[model samples]
Target: MPNVKPAMRVIYIPILLLFAAFLVIPLGILFIRSFETSEGFNFSNYIAVLSNQELLTSIGNSIKISSLTAVITTVLAFTLAYAVNCTKIYTPLKMAIKTGILLPMLLPTITYGFAIIYSFGNQGFITKLVGRNLVEIYGFNGLLIGYVIYTLPAAFLLINNSFKYIDKKFIIVSKLMGDGTLRSFKNTIVRPLVGTLGGAFVLSFIISFTDFGIPASVGGTYSVVATQLYQVMLGSIPNFNHGAAIAVVMLIPAVFGVLLLNYLEKRNFHYDKFGETELTPHRGRDVGFGIVSGVVLLAMLSVFAVMFVAPFVSSYPYDMTFTFKHLLDTFQSSDLTAVYKNSLFVALLTAVFGTCIAFSAAVLNVRTAVKGKSSLDTIAMMTNTVPGMVLGLSYLLFFNGSSLKGTFAIIVLYSIVHFFTTPYLMAKNALSKMNPTWETTGELLGDSWLKTVYRVLLPNSRSTVIEMFSYYFINAMVTISGIIFLVTAQTSLVSSKIKELQHFGKFNEIFMLSLLIFVTNLAVKLLCEAFQKKSNKQ
Candidate 1:
């Protein structure tokens, strides 16, 4: 309340109201519905969900798979990140490795499931090359692989960013003090990164646990909470109460993830000074890491290569003739074309408006002395812990009888709110790095807070703004969980269509549609990168 500018107060109103209408109220309705029973308000739904052996098993399966996936993904991601940062590799090789690691993010999570099947299924290319089925890809093994592919990029990004803040001088000092290599690495690198590793683990686990698309495609008969929630909510006979109960249960782990991440981050060690020591490569270590990282990158690229090739074949494993029939069919199908267009429209809208809202909120929170800005920040962060399935179902229940139930507008709004946190943080980071005296200088020269943002802040953060826009656009293009329930016939998206195509055993069309999405997102990403490079040069 003290020293809070009136302009800062005005900025909080719209942001808070937006979250209240789209996020808070809908989730509140979901919580209320979970408690409803046939007789009265009670725990019947919870009892039924917990007592059902199959449902409980799905919960257990999710935890088991997610935990295992987290461990494997964290190790691989950390290795890749360590090689990139800590070892000496050719610059092109390093860039290629980073690109390979991130390529998975451009496609939908379900696409990884498809890639796994296309690569390891009975008649898969790899299986054919090896002359046998190396592994079963229809159950736990497939789900784990899919989760690893889908979650590795995000985990690597987090862990890699953590490495940048550690001072290299600690390692040099440890060496000077007669410490061995292993002990030096433990004290300097591993000890400082424990918090980041835990955060990455929790994040990867939540993403794998709540993702419905991957499990739906590759988890044959192996149930998970996400797929179970989909079944209860949209199955032959829809049961809102049961669905709400499942959603409520899903929220437990997500909340725990947020709490656990916060706790770990708070306990992270703070170094007194950031050492300027540069990392020098040891010949043996560098060569060893280069070989290992090269193999990992190639393996990751092979999956996408299989996905790219699958759409061109006449029939996978049955016929080896190359044909564009599947791609033609994907575009020729009227419904599929409309869904693709819908995805484009939704992603475009989400990028433009989501960036504006996120930037404005960032300005209020980071650039001005806003009293209630923390409330807005808290609510925005809470959306991260709320699974997309839960948020989508909550919207379904809360807006059931409303006019916005089956509209594209609802999807756009839901996507914006669902993905608000990352873009907000991007904008905040960009703004925080600028000259803090910009606002004071503007005011002394007669510019208002809003004027300062437009003239001084926005222009300087143009690269970050473009990045935020691209982030929102790409995520909106590939996302299925949050908007799965919200998309209607008129607003069907390509990501949802991929799921439908999977259920009908249309593998060719599935790969074709997924390829379309991948190419589209990749093109956008490259364009953004080019723009950023040009801006930096200028």
Candidate 2:
């Protein structure tokens, strides 16, 4: 324990209210609805839902596809992380690989499904390039391809961060003790990364399992739990009981995934002294891993190449003429323009409010000895355990008919909660590294706690605050799940608008909007990085 200002505990009230109203109450309402029936409340709804063959098949399909995607994505993410960390590759090529791997995340997930269809579909750009039809972009193959791209960025971040704590000298010691190549590799690299590797797989699996954007665009005849839940709740005929039952069912795996991730994360290895150690040169290792990384990045990013061309062509694969009608037509519509502005409005507010709340929570958790600090930390990260669809459905249920329903405020709040854990963790980690005696020092100098924080802590935390803002802005701009059910006609976002367009076979508008979103998100990331570097220099 350390010296802490008692007045600082006042920060807990707003944070608690935020979670209680948005996270707890909504989930409780969902639980109640799951048991609701025509004859009062009972377990009949769950019975009926579990008994349905199609729903069961969707569950099985989610597991199978999510599992396979986790494996392939983990392998790709690990190889990329390895090449960046362990191998001595050319500087710019490695930088390109790092930047390219995260490009998929810069756009809405729905775009990925569309990209897959246009890239590997009948008249896909890749298809034309290869002069042949590619894999079926309808069922399992389509979902598998989209999911791998969707989850790779996050999985890579987790594994790559884990690499920093590992000391490579252990491999040298093992080699001196007569360890062979295979044995040395396992003992040094694989052993230290077991936890993060497992974490990557689990995170990838949950993300794929709960995603609705991809399945909505490319599901065709194959359905997953998210799509089924969407149909039941907002389809031609709404069934609240069945929808609630399915929502509850979706939480089962998320809960288990959270538990397993916690277990894996506990196996952390620490290094007392980290050195600027250079790896021994092996041209074979460098060339092999570098080529593999480059090839995989190319394959994943090649899916989106059509976005830049498909929207600018005259009926792709039929007419070889360049045109700007797609751009002109999309912008001419007031609705499309308003939707894009709405996305920017929501994203900006989410970043501002989200950064404040997350930073406050982190300041309390790391800088204060407040009672229940541990619980606050847990609550801050709890969003990771709930899937976006479930949270969206819960918000829709809890806030129905209230003033908050169909308002921009609700969307911003939900986005904050949905993407809160990562930013909060980022804040906590950055704050924990600062001087722990700032409060005491300020108090002795006759300064209030808030003043000290504003003058000292906030300035030191500028880079992290910028990062949290960027993360919130980018995610809020592209997210389609947690706020899908909450958006109404007046408060529509670009992502949901793209989904609406898909129903009418508007591929031109879809790719155009996707490009817009990707450019916006990429700009935010680049600006954040540059801002951080400039601040560090100052």
Candidate 3:
């Protein structure tokens, strides 16, 4: 028996209130507003959006670029994942490849556009080195490259985790049975990964289609839906009705991605065991895969290398002399300095409060047998399917005149709800593996349920707790879409400030602020890793 039966009930009240106030109600209002027009609620807003040829073209462009990005990113991710797991490569090179692949995640996606510009634009770093522009770093070409780099890390992670469990011994068996190389490879490898591959495509497509950061920076003359939605909502003539309609349309892919992914997940082949076997090492395979994977990793990392160069130069390409004037300029401006402080403030609070809410919901669902507890899981995770910009607009619609409108509380609240699903699932997974009889055993020892939870449950999952905190902190520091509309003049964040700097053609300042964000997130990530390792050893 749970030591105290009512303890579950006590925890349920606050979780329900928080979700009701933040997630459910705001989205509900946005849904209604999508139908609202000057003549009252109807379908005019949506109909007008669909009727516009420019808007329709932008939607088509989003599908085209996102589809291309998904395909290219998934293929590259597979190559990297295969190299890590299958090929015999230099160990130090493998470590570098893995780490470099995910370096983009440390900074905001909004910075991706600027990085691309400084890397390949006519007067760019690499262009100067090579003495020719490789590709135009704007419009469709830039969007393609930026979106690929942005989504590749996630695709690679999902595929890599799945690859670890695949039985490689089948490859040897297929070869010995006289199966051709293609047929043998298909049977041994791709068959088991069809579900994951499909899932990666959907995930990449959804992420690229819904992103605002990459599109905003590099999408010049290429009018994607994200930019169009921004024009309608925050443009010179703001229209809430139409913007909500576009946001509702943006939600279509997310919903489709979720449903498609769920279906694909069911098709995965679950193995009883992943038995290890010795590989037939081919020198050609090793060299081919090693060079290819190295090049891909280098290409992705090369994009951000300008962050180190652009900020320190007197004026990149023109003045080769090193200078700290750009750094000093940023620090001297009080307004700019406050943006960095605001990001730290929002991220820290979001980590603390978001962890509490997610952990509470997890404990409610996994530990207690409360009826309708699964509903909390559903609500907590629903944010995963909704785009961040859509969430920001929904909060704007619902909380337009409320006291929380211009406050940091609104940003923290949105961050918690936006990022609630993953952390909640992490906590739930961590708790599920603990002894189910822990509470019962504690009761025999005369410990109350709450007391047992604090003493036993909390200490056992401290590593997971640390991991959850780091996830919230890094994402909070880097996320832009959901929090973009919520930040005020007084509450500007470094992520949003990059946009402001972009408008003024201040490339150096943009790189400096990006570096600041990268350093901050890297610090949190390192601390969390060190702490988690210590906890594991203990």
Candidate 4:
């Protein structure tokens, strides 16, 4: 027993420590810096952050916009997920609808901003569709619309899967026992998905809260914490202190959202393990409700269609010509190519290293009988609350004099740490699904723990590893806020370059670049799906 305890520490404690260093240590450093003063520790930074009228206004704006988005998106996603899952929609048609809902998520948020501008800007194609423009698609409107697109896939997927897990027999029994359609729906479907609904709302709120791209493009003088962080770092007068203070402020909402999600995940995640229940179709309500839901799904698809097709138009609404010149010029530019290469290299390295760290942490938490696994959990939970911009600032302070400052290595490292939790949770889910008895039997048969991991765990986890890779790659490609500080001119990422062109009002080039990113991410996602199927077959 003595040998076993120490051996578990030997295997698990290193992973726990690494997570703590990467995730927990940086936040502590941020707090320490926030309290630092010329004379001694003080709350001057916090005082300034809290006292500023502009800061107060920005926080208010963020809350108002995020609240609007949460309600609209949740209602829409719930409608779509319910209509398709509960009704007799054709399977292929259902899959296509699901794909369309997810298409926006695969693209970068910057792309959504550009797409919205071209579709609704002053000289936009659809702007003229009305005799005169009734409302402007800037500020709150643009932010809310972009958020719905940005978060649709996740919210839809979450609720859609939740709907699938509910037993349709419950609904059928209710109807046969004289419950009305609306009455039965409320009692059976909505009640069961309440926790998931809350989970989706909080998740959407957090994504919108931390996003830096959409507001930058179409916000049009709209002030929020994300854009405020950008303004602080602008024009060669880097305000690291102010930025860190704002970053710490942003951490409050993100932390609360994460805590809420953790609570809901624990309460509502059981249906998934209980397995999918069979459906009993309703005739009258299914037809009418399904048609209404289909219209909403079509509207969701129309947004993606506009985003994909707008780049091919030669000039805005004026020329209305068609050409591939925009595409040719975007990839043909040597500057853009360098940025693309930098982004690709960093994404590849992040996938490798992020996967390594997440896999290790998951194994340590699940397999090893170590005392400090709670430490790893704490790191992940705290990191999930840390916004990307704050993370960037933290790296600037922590690694400025170390061996990591101002290099491509640091950017890659930042990506790995910035995106650690998603993959960690994903891999943990995959690990938990497998029977722990597999490991026990292997140990009883005299196999070493290491051999059992290689021979048992890795093979069973091939799908998860691929999913982890896609998550890392897509996030790294679209990430703007964290790597923005780390990317030198020599090592510019595509995300930063897109922001550059947008600032210069090169809207055409911006849309083309966004299209390219969407295509590249789509290709990567497809590749991951293929690999998942191959692994399943094996």
lDDT of 3 by residue, 103-165 (tens): 898999999999999899998878888899999878999999999999999899889988898
- Which regions of candidate 3 are displaced past 4 Å? 1-4
On residues 1-538, what C-alpha lDDT tens digit does candidate 2 reach at each position? 2455656757877787888899888989999999999899999999999999999999999999999999999999999999998889888878998888888888999899999998999988898999998798898999999999999999999999888777878877887999999999998899889889999999999999999999999988887888989989999999988999999999898889888878977876767776666788799999999899989989998999889988888887688589999899989989888999999999999999999999998888888777777876667656888899999999998899799999999999999998999999999999989988887788789889888889989999999999999999999999998788999999999999999999899999888888888888999999999999998897
Could you tally the backbone clashes for each prediction? 0, 0, 0, 0
lDDT of 3 at 119: 90
lDDT of all predictions: 0.88, 0.90, 0.90, 0.78
- Please, what are the lDDT tens digits per residue for candidate 4 over residues 1-538? 0124445666576666665665567767877877776768887878887898897898899988987888888888898888777777667667777777877766668777777776677765456665565457888888887888888788898899788678777777798899987899987788889889998899788888888888987787788878887777664687667667778888889878877887876666334334444566657867776676677777555555555556677766666688788778877888877777787888888888888778878877877666667676777776677778888878877776777777888888788877888899988888888887876788789877778778989889999999999999888888887777677788888888888887688877776676777788899999999999999999
Candidate 3 is scored at a TM of: 0.97
Better of 1 and 4 by TM-score: 1
Q: Please provide TM-scores, in order, for all candidate models, with all chains considered together.
A: 0.97, 0.98, 0.97, 0.92
List CA RMSD, all candidates: 1.7, 1.4, 1.4, 2.7
Candidate 4 colliding pairs = none
